[model samples]
Target: MNRLFNLVNQQDNRQLLMNTIRNGRVANAYLFHGPEGSGQEGFALEYAAMLNCQSRENQPCGQCPSCHKMKTLEHGNIHLVFPIRTGSLEKNDPPFKNFGPDDMEEIQNCIRKKAENPYEKLCPFDGKHIPINFIREIRRKIYLTAPEPGYKVVIVFDADLMMEPAANAFLKILEEPPDKTLLILTTSNIDAILPTIRSRCQRLHFPALSTTDLGNHLRENGIREDRINLVMRLSGGDVRQAIQLKEADLGRLREMTLEALRMIAIWKIDKVYDLVNRFVTLRKENPDEFDRLMLSISFWFRDAAILKAGKPESDLVHADMQIEIRKFVDYYTELDAFGAYSAVDNCIDLISRNVYINLALVNMFFKIHNRIQPGKSQ
Candidate 1:
């Protein structure tokens, strides 16, 4: 068993994939669909290792030469494609496409980090998407055929991030790949993938981790029990997010979430402007943290909802904020907590679609304001 699969607590997926390999039912192309932080990508790498392992029995002998290469992600047969941003995108470029020499170095470094930690994010640049050239490079290698005898395993992480042209170009390869090739497309949003492409691949779903597993992992990380309880709720069984939240000093994000609620509750022009600007900076400086900030607020409102529904404070995820939640609930006698949560969720959706941050946030502020304090001006 791969060590990373254990890290992600993907026992079921591990069994399923091992069975596929043993039964010789591996598909030419597979779609790994699951929520973010699930073990889709990790399992994809593990599957590649199993297929290319040198030993016939007791597959993926980590001691084998091919297995060692897969461990470092330097195997000649492995093709990894993810969202990438380069300084240039020259039409006639190959391998790296428009990427300059410096970009290639950075990419290698990123790969080294990925080899170290499977969950390390690949792209440093923002708003990157899978490019057509990357797809072409893989197709080129498949046709050229490397000298080595191994499965040509192509794993495209976040496949839904590919734009239409790239997706369309990819469909050609997906529709018809060489005999010894396997392509796995991993995505958190399957609906974003084109229907044509989806229809052609064998789909495998990765379910979120269980709360018990999440808590046990957090405990192993030496996180405090108090924080573990909160993370178990906020991370929603997302293994990567649980790890990130532990290292990210998620307390700061929670504090910011509380402060942002106070700002919105004020419903003043200057305060709202300052809040939005702060968020813009957070989004640019630390996108993951910013995302958690929004997620944190939704749960805060959920806690408020619990209080409004006459539930005890023990029912609140934000039990520490019981006093504040009680006061907020008391003040807004007609507050619709779910509606407020939806307003924030809508803002997350808008930002995800590359909507202007200022507009998305401002619209969210006003929407919540109107929902709770009807006709309230900001």
Candidate 2:
């Protein structure tokens, strides 16, 4: 359970942060801003451990008394604020209002697994978003004196989930935290958070991992070489997502995308209708898994385009789908390729808006089908 800052993959960013620690210019409030699964929370936890370690030379010794406690997230001076179920507040519902020890345990498990295997599944849920009651609890604790010899580090993960009231309620503390207090907020949805809160914290953005790095990470994680290309293309340089993709089964979705493309290219209205109906059924029966299907379809066209251009298998975004991509490219026109991309973008936009999943997927099918066959426009 060594600190995440000590991770070999993040040495460069760690060095930059260490320089700030050495200079004694630590800010009261810091924001780790980036997309999900970029290692922001791990970085924050490592820094907190370093800040509280009894024998901090350049980083946390990971062997000291303070380090041991911090590793388990039980350090008195280090606090965690995250979202919890409202049921936790009701005696008949659960324990701890809006947050409890279980929330902490879930996060701890994810962190531990991530540290053990860099390619472990990466997800944005660190036990839900920050609730208003959780904010109140944090305010009460931070308003008091430090519990240890060093700084009081309060790491708030997924800060963007804060409701408007909670965001405003915490603004005052961010502006003027108590002595020896440090606030580190991490989130992928920074825009949803209050501008006032954003302005108060020193922001650090974590970039997406490089494609080569993601591929190498996947290879090391024992992912099958055949599926690595599809995962990398669909992940778009997000290693966390790449790892998740590795855990999914995409054979059926691959078959669906190929047939859907073929139907659209031939201007077969009945076949297109059948495809959408089947997809809608698949989505309804497996609502939680629709996103993977969408991603598979999206990557199919990406690989097809590369195949059409006579690109080598290694040059394809979905190298693993070379055979499938070549099959589509053999019959698909340039117009068909562009149409598929637009459909995917439209589906993403609609999904983000919380639209009905079945309707959105069907609409995307119609849009792509019509683009390929003007005569079948509805």
List model 1 lDDT by residue over 332-375, tens digit each: 77788889989999999999999999999999988887667623
Roughly what TM-score does model 2 have, to 2 decimal places? 0.76
Error of 1 at 250 (Å): 2.0
lDDT of 1 at 231: 80
Model 1 worst lDDT run, 10 consecutive residues: 1-10
Using lDDT as the measure, the top candidate is: 1
How far does residue 191 in candidate 2 sit from its true spot (Å)?
A: 2.7
Model 2, residue 54: displacement in angstroms?
3.3
Model 1, position 64, has a per-residue lDDT of 86
Model 2: per-residue Cα lDDT over 1-378, one tens digit each: 245332325556677677778899888998987766566777788888888877747468878888877766668898776654443343232224344477657756765664454334323253354556667777788778777788899887778877676687789788678988999998878888788898899988876666666667788877888777777766666666666654445566566566766665665667766766776777669753566667777777666666666766776655656776665565344446666777887897887798986678667877775554332323
Model 2 residue 347 CA deviation (Å) reads: 5.5
Highest TM-score model number: 2
lDDT of each: 0.80, 0.69
